[model samples]
Target chain A: MDATPVPETTATPDTECHTTHGYISDKARYLARLKRIEGQARGIHRMVDEEQYCIDILTQISALTSALRNVGLGLLDDHLKHCVVDAAQLGGEDAEAKIKEASDAIARLVRS
Target chain B: MDATPVPETTATPDTECHTTHGYISDKARYLARLKRIEGQARGIHRMVDEEQYCIDILTQISALTSALRNVGLGLLDDHLKHCVVDAAQLGGEDAEAKIKEASDAIARLVRS
Candidate 1:
C-alpha cells in the first residue's frame, strides 16, 4: 500500500555497500572454467552435427556434465565459506534462509 | 604378423554394412537440443563475465547439467533399444562386449 511505512531493517545503501558475491575473489578462474565449458558445449554440438558415434557423443556429454558439476561444487564451496559463514556469524533469519538456500542448491546439483 | 591368416570372424564389409548409430533417426531433434545447450553454456559464460550473482549462476549451471543428463539418458535409451538389442540378438562375444560397454557408459553417466 502507498500508506505503508518503509521497514527500517530493509537493506539500504550503507548495508548494501559491502555486499559482494562469494565467487568475486575467484572470478577470473571461474570465467576461464566457464569459457572452457562453453567450448565443450560447442564441441558436443559439432560432434552431433557430424553424426559421430553415439557412445562418443555420450562420452562428451558426460565430460561436459562433469565440468559443470565441478563448477557448481566450487561455487557451493565458496558460498558456504563466505556467504553462509558470514550469515551464520550474524545468527538470525537471514542465516537460516542462507542455509536453506544452500541445501536446495545441493539437492538440485545432486539430482541434476 | 604379415604372414598370419586374417580371422574370418573379424568384421568385413558385409558385417559392417548395416552398422549405424541408434540416434540417427532422431538426429535433427538431438542437434536442435545440443544447439540450445551450446547457447545455454554461452549464456552462463556471459553471466560470469558480467559478474552476475553466484547463486543465479549456480542455478544456470544446474539447468545446463540437467539438460545434458537428459540427453545422455535419451541417447542411452536409443542405444539399448537399437544397438544393444541388435547385438544381443546375435548372441555371442559381440553381444557380451556391447552389454559391457553399455554398463560402463551407464556407470560414467551416474558418476558424472
Candidate 2:
C-alpha cells in the first residue's frame, strides 16, 4: 500500500466550486469598497508618520475598525442565509454539522 | 421630497446575484457542520439546565466558541482569496475598496 493514503472524503460530493457570475459581481462591489478602505488606511499611516493630531488618527482608526466589522458581519449574514440553510435541507449529519458550525461561528463573532 | 429617496446609484452594476451550483454545495457542507455544532450547543444547554459542573459547561462553551470562529475565518479566507482578488483584477476603485474593507475586518477580528 502506498504510504500516502488518500484522505477520507467528507459528506460533500465533489462538485464545481467556482463563484457564480452574480456572486462575482457582488464580490466586485465588495472589493471596490475594500479598496477605498485601503486608501483610508494608507492615509492613516501617513497621518501617523507625519505626527498628525493623535485624536484625529485615533478617530480614523476607529472608523476603519468599524467599517471592517461591518464587512465581516455582512458576509456572515450572506453565508448563513445561503450556505448553512441549504446544507440543513439536504438532510443528514452534513446539514446538522453545517448549522452547528455556523452557530459556533456566529457565537465567536458576537464575542469578538 | 419623497420620503423614500431612490438609493444613490453606486459603482456596482446590478446583476443576477445567486450562489452558483458550486457555491451552493460548499454552503451545504458548511451548514451540515453547523448542525452538528447546534446539537452540541443544545447539549451544553442541557448540561447547564441539569446543573452539571460549571467547569464542564464552560469548557464546552469555549470549544463551541472556537469552532464558530474557525468557520468564520474559513469563510473569510475563501472570500478574500476568490471575491476580493477577482475584483482587484477588474481595475478601477472597486478593487482597492474591497481590499481595504477586508483589512479592516481582519483588524477587528484580531482585536476581538
Candidate 3:
C-alpha cells in the first residue's frame, strides 16, 4: 500500500456545505434570546433567595425552558436547511456522516 | 508570588455542582424523543425528494424544530434544578462561572 494517508477533509466546503448554516444571518435574534434567558435565570435565582413559593419558581423555570427551547429550534432549523442538505448533496461518506451526526446530536440533546 | 497559579478548579464538584443534571434520570425518555425526531427529519427529506407541496414540507420542518426544542427544554430543566442550583449554593467564583457558563450555553445554542 502507498505510504501517503488519504485525504479526509476537503480543502473547501463542497457546494452547499458551507458549514456555517444560518448563524450569521440569525446572530442578532439569537443573542437577544440569550440575553432574555440570562435575565430569566437571574430572576429565578432571586426568587429562590427570597424563599418564594415552589410552584411559582417551577412556573418560571418552565418559561425559561421554553425560551431556551425556542432558541434551539431556531438553530436546528438552520442546521437542517444548510448543513444537512449541503452534505446530502455531496453524496458520500460526508453525506452519510452528517445525517448520522445530526441524529446523534438530537439524541444527545434529548438526554442532556 | 509563587510561580504556581491560583487553584481555579476544585478537586471535585463543589457541593451541588455535580456537573450532571437529569440526563441520567431521563435518558430513556430523551432517546425516545430523538428517535421520533430522526423519523421526522427523514420523513421531511423524503417529502422533499418526492416533490411534496411547499406547505406540507414547511409543516414538517416546524414539527421537527419543535421536537428538538422540547429536548432543549428538558435539558435546561435539569441544568437549573441541579447544576445551576449547586453552583449558586457554592457562592464564589465557581458559582459565578457556572451561572455565566449556563447563560453562555444558552447563547451558543441560540446561535448554533
Best by DockQ: 1
- For model 3, residues A45-67, the per-residue Cα lDDT tens digits are 44444433333433454555555
Q: Mark the regions of model 2 whose C-alpha exceeds 4 Å error after superposition.
A: A1-112, B1-25
How many clashes does the backbone of model 3 have? 0
TM-scores of all predicted structures: 0.82, 0.41, 0.43
Better of 2 and 3 by lDDT: 2
Q: Write the per-residue lDDT of candidate 3 for residues B47-91, one digit (tens) a residue.
A: 434433322333444455555555666666777787778778877
Q: After superposition, how far is residue B77 of candidate 2 from its true place, in Å?
A: 1.6
Of the candidates shown, which would achieve the greatest TM-score relative to the real structure? 1
TM-score of 1: 0.82
Q: What are the Cα lDDT values of the candidates?
A: 0.74, 0.61, 0.52
Let me know the DockQ for model 2: 0.03
Better of 1 and 2 by TM-score: 1
Question: Tens-digit lDDT track for model 1 on B62-107?
Answer: 8889989999999989888888888889878778777777787788
Model 2, CA-based lDDT: 0.61
Docking category for candidate 1?
acceptable
Which rank order by TM-score, best down to worst? Answer: 1, 3, 2
Error of 3 at A38 (Å): 1.0
